[model samples]
Target: MHVPEQIPDHLDFVGRGWHPLLTRLHEQLVAVSPSYSVQQVKEKYGTLRIHLYTGMLRHLNLGNTDWPDPDQAARYKDEDDAARALVHAAEQESARTCEACGNPGVPRDRAWIKTLCDDCAGHR
Candidate 1:
């Protein structure tokens, strides 16, 4: 499938319309933690799906037996929560945005599910 050049290679599977949203999400994620990296980005059931590489959580020994200080774990948990919230927000937005033209739209189901504005949907 066609992919946008502006987006990072990891997000090439996503549509151009979601590029801005994903970019903003990335910026917000980086602000949360430089260690965070995108694992995968794709469209699933007409909505955006973003998976992040949470190496920090592992490095911090979140769920391991060699758990470190409790305070450190708490801080990492907060950061992880914030990151998850951002991803959830972006996914919710993608549901209403036209995947083809970036216009406000609703999900349509035909051969496959996709979010498209009235104009784009009509053309389809």
Candidate 2:
């Protein structure tokens, strides 16, 4: 594990084997690109939501449009709901099976906490 004293300005070890610095360089390149930062995205388009990015990429053919159409908005909402549901299901499943005690964990709050399943939650 050898870390360079200072990263070079334009270091290119293309043909050399695996380098950990490559990951950092890639991240820096993405950060500097117009397609990366939310601030840059907001400046170009008012909002910084993922759906907005999707709309910009998919619907308007990546044109210089800001607002999403009603159809796109609806689709985005549907996708959001589906994602939330998947997260909830995953959290609930995790709590339902306790690796430590093999007892069922209880859901703290139905609104916020994921509901545990019967086996691990201790409660029937």
Candidate 3:
């Protein structure tokens, strides 16, 4: 994971770490790049940027962000976009489970829908 210096304060060190979904995605995209290298990971307005984020990420075109090569930036545009889709899917999966404890869950009616395990869903 290569999180940019500019990120929401909410995303501390823990957010920079690769989530289980990302680990799996990276393994799957080895053909594209030996390993995924994110150029940015930030929350826009209803979508995530470069990582699987079930918590806080937004986009006008949700799940359509890019993850260009940190070094080349645009050399692997297609490949990065493909990897970004995988990450997006994982984020969507997170919405159906608990981000805190990873248990079966459903969306709660808030300004934004967030899925949480029974134990972690309480009062959220």
The candidate that wins on lDDT is 1
Q: Rank the candidates by lDDT, best first.
A: 1, 3, 2
Instruction: Sort every candidate by TM-score, greatest first.
Output: 1, 3, 2
Residue 10 lDDT in candidate 3 = 27
TM-scores for every candidate against the unseen true structure: 0.81, 0.30, 0.49
Clashes in model 2: which pairs?
103-120, 104-120, 104-121, 104-122, 105-120, 105-121
- Kindly provide the TM-score of model 3 when superposed on the true structure, using C-alpha atoms: 0.49
Candidate 2 vs candidate 3: the lDDT winner is 3
Per-residue CA lDDT of candidate 1, range 23-111, in tens? 88877877776567565688989999877754345454334666658887787788888888988999999999998888898999999
Predictions: Cα RMSD each: 5.7, 16.3, 9.4
For model 3, residues 43-118, the per-residue Cα lDDT tens digits are 3322334552221122212354664346544545555576567767865665565545556666565676555567
Model 2: residues >4 Å from true position, as ranges? 1-65, 99-124
Each prediction's number of clashing residue pairs: 0, 6, 5
The prediction achieving the highest TM-score against the true structure is 1
What TM-score does prediction 2 earn? 0.30
| Candidate that beats the other on lDDT, 1 or 2, i.e. the better one | 1
